[model samples]
Every structure is written in structure tokens, then in C-alpha cells.
Target: MVSRGYKKRGVGVMGLRHVKNPILLARAMLEHGEDDLEANPRGVNSGDLDVPSAQGHTQLYGKAAEQLAQQYELELVDPSYFFTQRRWDEHVRALEREKKGQGQATWSATEYLPQGTCGAVALDQDGVICAATSTGGLTNKLTGRIGDTPAIGSGFWAEEWAEDGDPTGSSTWDR
Candidate 1:
């Protein structure tokens, strides 16, 4: 699912499971610069190109997720978005507060999942699956930083329902 927020940003989610290593998918993004602007810009680069500096902080988590998948041989999935750091920070803080038993709060969808956002979610035939996602994260991210990508569960997850005849289990990361 790709979510975009008005005057804010957008996000995407990709999910997978029951495979060899789910984390590997996340890790691969880092090794190959899945979201590096220098390596994967949206437009042609000219000598006088005035494009803003692109951010790849989310790739950190994508790599981490890939590593976990490789080590555990589990399926992996990820959701990504192009959102502002402030909005990402808000989601992070909200998740943290929720962990502390705080009541649920409504977030501004327009500021989180805006239009023009795109992503993918993949599932295996037997219900096992893997997913990957990418985005520019907060149009103007800081010079040196990271986001929820490295935070497991928050960025990706492997879920199994009773219909699958397996005990409900999941792997997640939080930061």
C-alpha cells in the first residue's frame, strides 16, 4: 500500500513470509543502493541540475531487514513511503507511545500517504511471502540520518494466521 499525505509526505508497505530468509531482502537494498539518488535519480542530471539532495535513510532499515531474513531463512515484506522526517518522527513517537500503553491516536493520512505514491506487496502461493518498498522519505530529510526502515516490525513483518496452521508468530524491529 502506498500512502501519501497532503503538505506532508507518502509511504508504502510490502510484506512477505514463509521463505528462507526475509531479512535478506532488506539487506540487499543497502548493498545495491536501492534508493540512492546518485545511483537512481528520478530525472536526467545536467551540469546545472537544481534537483534537491535526495535521502536514503530508509535504506538502512531495508538492509537490516534483509540481513535478518538471510540469517533466519524467513520471508520478508516491507512498506515504504515518501514523507517528511517530521511525519516519520511522529509515527515513530506514536508507535513508542503505543508500546507504553498509550491510547490510539489518529494521524493525518494526507500528511502520511499522499497521491502519486506507489509501491508493491508480494505474497507466496502458499501464503508465505516477501515484500520490499522504497521512497524519498520526508522531501527534505537531514544530511546524515536514518528512519523507520531499520526498525523491524515497524518497517516490515512476517505474519502467520491460524488458517496457515502455524502458531501466530512475527518478527519486528523498533527504534
Candidate 2:
């Protein structure tokens, strides 16, 4: 599961039971469906193809991924695998803070806050760029709220680039 969120950002992936790493899961989901994209030219390099609705994030913690896992012979661990004393302690602290009205005031502090996502961006050996990210979300949050991390273009996005007139290859990419 993508994990739950705070008042600002909701849990992006809900009810994830056995998956250990969402980043890897997200990457797997991408790689798993890349062939389908390659076979269909209409989706190639199109942002629409990379959108969240098409990325299958909505199929979490249910029959869809479970069925796929079974078909692929993938191992599914108990949700207890995600349990940790440290995480529980953090959740307790967050709740205490909220009760005292000491919670964070802004969502923009995500990168610097105690809770945040992990991401990796790389220019692969084939010169193809790819990015991936995942988060456990805010502690003691609503389990059904999906955070931005699993929201495709919001938390992670990659697109091929080519410069038409820049010979020095110094053009900047902007969202």
C-alpha cells in the first residue's frame, strides 16, 4: 500500500496487505505493463499513458493485484511484516501532537518533515530516464487516503527529451 496521509495528503494506496516496498511495487507495475505500451503506439511517450488512472494504483489491496500475484507465483507476506516498534512509536507521537494542536501547519514541508517519501531517478544504461517514489504516509492517518507519492505524475514522472536547436544539450525540462 502507498500508506496513509495527514489532513493535507491522503493515503495514496489503500489497504496494502503484504507488499514490502511500494517503490518496487510501483516499478514492477510500470515494467509489468511497459510491453503493452510498446505494442500500442498511441500510448508511446504520451503523458496520458503515464497517468495515475492507467498506472493501476487503484487496484491495490484487492483481488486485482492479488490475482496477478497468484498468477505470477509471487510471495505475499502477512501484513504483520510491515509492523515495527519504531513506526508505532512515531504514530503515537503524531497523535499526541495532534491532540495538543502541535501538528505541522503546512504540507509543503514534506521534503524536510519527519515523514516523507523515497525516490530514485536515473539515466539508465540505455540512456532512458526513469523515476520512482513511494511513501508510508503520515503516521496515524486514515488508511484509505492515497498520498501524492503514488499519484503518478504528481510524485514521480519521466519523459524522453530531445532538443531541436540546442547543440550543447543544455535545455532545461519543466513540469
Give the lowest summed-lDDT range of ten residues in model 1: 1-10
Model 1: what TM-score? 0.28
In the range 1-175, model 1's lDDT, one tens digit per residue, is 1211211222222333232332344333333332435432434645433322223333222333343344434453333332356666766765665557665543545545442233355565765444444433443334444456533456544444444333445423221
TM-score of each: 0.28, 0.61
Return the number of clashes found in candidate 1.
Answer: 46
Best by lDDT: 2
All models: lDDT?
0.39, 0.50
Q: What are the per-residue Cα lDDT tens digits for candidate 2 across 117-170?
A: 677666757766666566667766666776666664576566665557655666
Cα-based lDDT at residue 48, candidate 1: 30
Which ranges of candidate 1 are over 4 A from the true structure?
1-118, 164-175
Off by over 4 Å in 2: 1-14, 34-63, 97-113, 166-175
Please list the Cα RMSD from the true structure of every candidate, rounded to 1 decimal place: 16.9, 11.0
